[model samples]
Target chain A: MQMLRKLSAGLLLLAVASFASTPAAEAAGQTLEIVKKRGHLKCGVSQGLPGFSTPDNRGNWTGIDVDFCKAVAAAIFNDADKVKFTPLSAKERFTAIQSGEVDIIARNTTWSMHRDTALGVDFPVVNYYDGQGFMVRADLGVRSARDLDGATLCTNQGTTTELNAADYFRSNGMQYEIVAFEKADESVAAYNSGRCDAYTTDHSALYAQKLKLSDPKAHIVLPEVISKEPLGPLVRQGDAAWNDLVRWTHYATVAAEEFGVTSKNISEMKSSSNPSIRRLMGQDGSFGDNLGLSKQWAVHIIRAVGNYGEIFERNVGVKTPLGIKRGVNALWTKGGLQYAPPIR
Target chain B: MQVLVLAAVLGAMAWLVGNVQSNLERQNINSGFGFLSERAGFGINQTLIAYTEDDSFGRVLAVGLLNTLLVSALGIFFATLLGFSLGVARLSRNWLISKIAMVYIEIFRNVPLLLQIMFWYFGVLRNLPSPRQAVSIGDAIFMSNRGFVVLWLEASAGAFWYGLAALGLVIGGIWLRRRAANAQITTGQATRVWRPLLGLAVALFGGAALMAGVPFALDVPHLKGFNFRGGLTVIPEFVALLLALSLYTAAFIAEIVRAGINSVSKGQREASAALGLPESVALRLVVIPQALRVIIPPLTSQYLNLTKNSSLAVAIAYPDIVSVLAGTTLSQVGQALEIIFITMMIYLSLSLLTSWAMNRYNQRMAFVGNNT
Candidate 1:
């Protein structure tokens, strides 16, 4: 009995001591420095979302969100090759970031008020401003989300779109039942199987799903924008410098677009007398130093992937086969919300 | 020396983790269980226990744990009953009877559980017609893509009074059995087991209704515009999870049951027959008692595995522990360490408790067999 008591006491003491030291350990910041020494930025992304993040036949990742991941790598190491992308599911996305398994999440996740205030993570700057919409067979004659009042909605699990749906239904005084699937693939399959009345998700994703249908022209996304879904990259709570470096990597692309810079002409513009261009490229100033990076960090980003317009136009926008227009994602100067802070 | 070596290794691991934590903290990234107390701002796909998006991580974990228990218990109860019955049928001497049982086991046992769960959840259950085209069993009961909602009787206060009176009669019957059993030993008067069995059944239900002054009331389900009103509703996710688990585990149980029966000696059956026992009574009162000793241990483990595999509820977003705490709440609060550790501990406790209870029951069964 005494021996058992002693053993249990030892275990209890170990548990309590470990529990007691957590905050003290968290107060010190050595892991971020450890990551810097490791050289590669670990970014978690989706496995397959077509234009956002998907693996090619060669196993190399290529998409708009993927390019942003490499851009952060360039901002940090002046080499876009230093990023390692981790493919995560909707269910695994949060835990991967929360457990420090991945340093940052570039999955097309929405920034909700509850997630921001409660999730111990921060989503800064909307990379893609999407809205919740419904996609249905064109023959169904569904022209609006409001028409989905009594329609069965097929949606993926563990998403803000689920709650946004409930709010939309309640406020509109519409009655509809949800048919939720854990994976997006299952929802798509069920929708195709004629199990649901319509599929609901972000407008961009609805377009993607529509294109994957047996006959792409047979389906159309309804015109109603029900909720504001600002999809962006997220970093863990704390670590201001790393967050700024990541957040600015996204901003640098927009800033580059605004300066009329393209990857094709950036090399020649290095000697241009444009003051904002000089500051952005870090050719004339200490903007890079403030972010704890190299003077040519922006230049390296442009060389490896080009500006935001090149990245989007090559993958998801009108230039590519997805054929999505640059509606709300255009540069602020072009009358949209893609605004970047002035480096001055 | 080995103990000291292991302790040294454990200490080194702790030191390494501590070093990494301090380094991460200096870079201003928070760590540890502080995140668990934060609010869970996301909604789950299906929740059995009540919850809101605003509920704390602790409450969410509780909901997940409840869902895990609900499904696993139901799976174990049904699988064991079906498995043991089929297992006996497999060992039957009749050619046609045994052949059918062999085919049933082979077909179900060979398929992977995950494929079955996916097949039921996505392919089969989702194919059901919409609520608007609900399939009613009779005019009084309704079933459809919405779900089956049937009429149920609710016991009221006056129903309890009559129930207790019936229970008292059952107790009187059981008392008569004890007296008769003692008389059978002393004066050679046999007592019927059915008398006490029937009495116990009457006591349980009658006592509930009669002593509590509860009356019986019927609750009839009604269908409204798009859904059923005033009846218990089971979701497709739950139906799929239950069907897949029960079918997967039952095939294994049947084999264990067959093995237990085969392990029994022919001498036992012959001895019972020589004592003038009928075939049905020889198999039940003689053969099964001995076979139970062989059947129980592996049967218990199968039940435990079924329980643990229910954690795959995460795959279907069944609001089980893995999906709610490890999947949703962990992301909501970033409390990865605390939530996962607590979940593992709970599962470990559940399995251990089950094993302990099974061990106790097996001991009692074994002791009785040995004496016989």
Candidate 2:
């Protein structure tokens, strides 16, 4: 009994000591220093959401989100492969970042006011302009969202998509049932097996997942975009420098596309007469230095992952299996939402 | 010294909580239960109570808890019944029956419970035909990918009074059984209690039910446009989870039962047989009571395991407490600290209550004095 009492006392002291040491640990901007010290960026992505971040049989990560992570690595180390991917579920993604398990979360998470203010995470830029939409069988004769009365919809649980779906049906006075699954694949499988009349998620994900159905030609995606979903890369709060670096890594891709700079012609564009392109390519000014990166960081990003347009078209655009049209995702000059601040 | 140790532990706990609070403040993560009263704004497919998208998070949590308990209770009931049968079958003299029971226990216990649940859900239940091609039973029950629809009784207004009459009959039957047992013990006269008690109960409940124009009516399922129109529709999630949980837990329970029966000595059974008691009566009156002494303790653990393992309902999206409340609600509210702590406390209390009740039964069955 005496030994047991002493053991418990020792445990109590250890607990208190551990608690006393945490405040000093979280101070002094730890994320960037740790990343540089480790020499690799731990980027969190989706478990297997096609066109976002799915791995091939060779264990190589692909898709647009994977490209964004590689671009960040290139800007920091001039080597896109100096990054490791951590596949996470939507329920576990925020906690993963908050706990410092991953440096940045590039998962296709929607930016919302509640998440920004309360979840202790900050979204620096929207990488994908997405919105909630529904996909149903063509034979259902459901032409629009209003035609989905008395329909059973399958979706991934613990997401903004579930709430938006419920609110839409409730406000429209339509009776519907939602069969939510823990993972995106489970929801897709259920939808494919005819357990639900429609499958609802982000418009881009619906397009990507529809290609996996046994009879892909039988389903048609509805045209209505129910909720604004500005998907972006997120980082833990209070790391200003790291957040800025990740933010600019994405913007550099968008800005590259706007300047009509292809990855093949990036080296040749260095001699361009356009002053903005010269400054963006780091031939003039301290644009990269201001963000605590090398002068040619944008050049490294472009060479590593190409521009935003290239990444999208190769992974999910008209020629890919997903074949998603760039509607609102087009450049701002072309009447869309992909805008980047001037490099100057 | 013990008091000092407890005080040190308490001090550590308080300091840790203070550390978390400061960290949360710095990170700007909200730390309160005020989100409980906010609108849930999400739909649940299956709910025991009245719920809508506009319901509060508190109501959603309550609904999730009810669903968790409902599945766990059903799993425990069916697993125990199947386990006791398999346990006896394993000990049967017939070699084929014993081998069949052994094979069942081996197959279920070797595989992980989560895999079993997913196999039943995705591989088996999800492959069923859609509602358009639903398989029906006697034109009253239907099975499809949507759900299993069964004909059920819809009670009328007079059913309430009829239920009261049935309760009274049950109480009278219990009294008659005690009187008959006492009469047989003291006077050596076997009273026909079952016939009289059953007759009285039937007359009371059945007569009142008939006079009230049959207080219950059958609600049959019919084919609708895309699904069944009426009756109680059991969701595929519940069926798959329940089937997996009961089968997996019953395997462990069968082993426990076998060990319990073996713990009872052969001499006790032989003695009962020498006393001219029939084989069935001797096994029930002598062997079972002794076997129960060993069974009740471990049996409590299996029950608790079933309850906690029900948390795996999330994998198949059964909307249990962990899936709906701690999972979806926690992500929506971003109050993981409070939500996880509350879920842990709820499960702890449930296990404690179950063990407490089982311990009482164990004490009743314990030997009166130290004889061995």
Highest lDDT among the candidates is held by which one?
2
Each model's Cα RMSD: 5.4, 2.2
Worst 10 residues of 1 chain B by lDDT: B22-31
Off by over 4 Å in 1: A1-40, A75-82, A98-100, A112-124, A134-154, A166-181, A194-199, A213-226, A289-294, A319-323, B1-62, B139-230
lDDT of 1 at B75: 92
**lDDT of candidate 2 over A198-309, digit per residue (tens):** 9999999998899889999999999999999999999988888888998889889999999998799999999999998998899999989887788999999999999999
Q: Highest DockQ: which candidate?
A: 2
For each candidate in turn, the TM-score is 0.82, 0.96
How displaced is residue A194 in candidate 2, in Å?
Answer: 2.2
Q: Candidate 2 at residue B335, lDDT?
A: 80
- lDDT at residue A246 of model 2 (Cα atoms): 87
Reference contacts preserved by each model: 0.18, 0.68
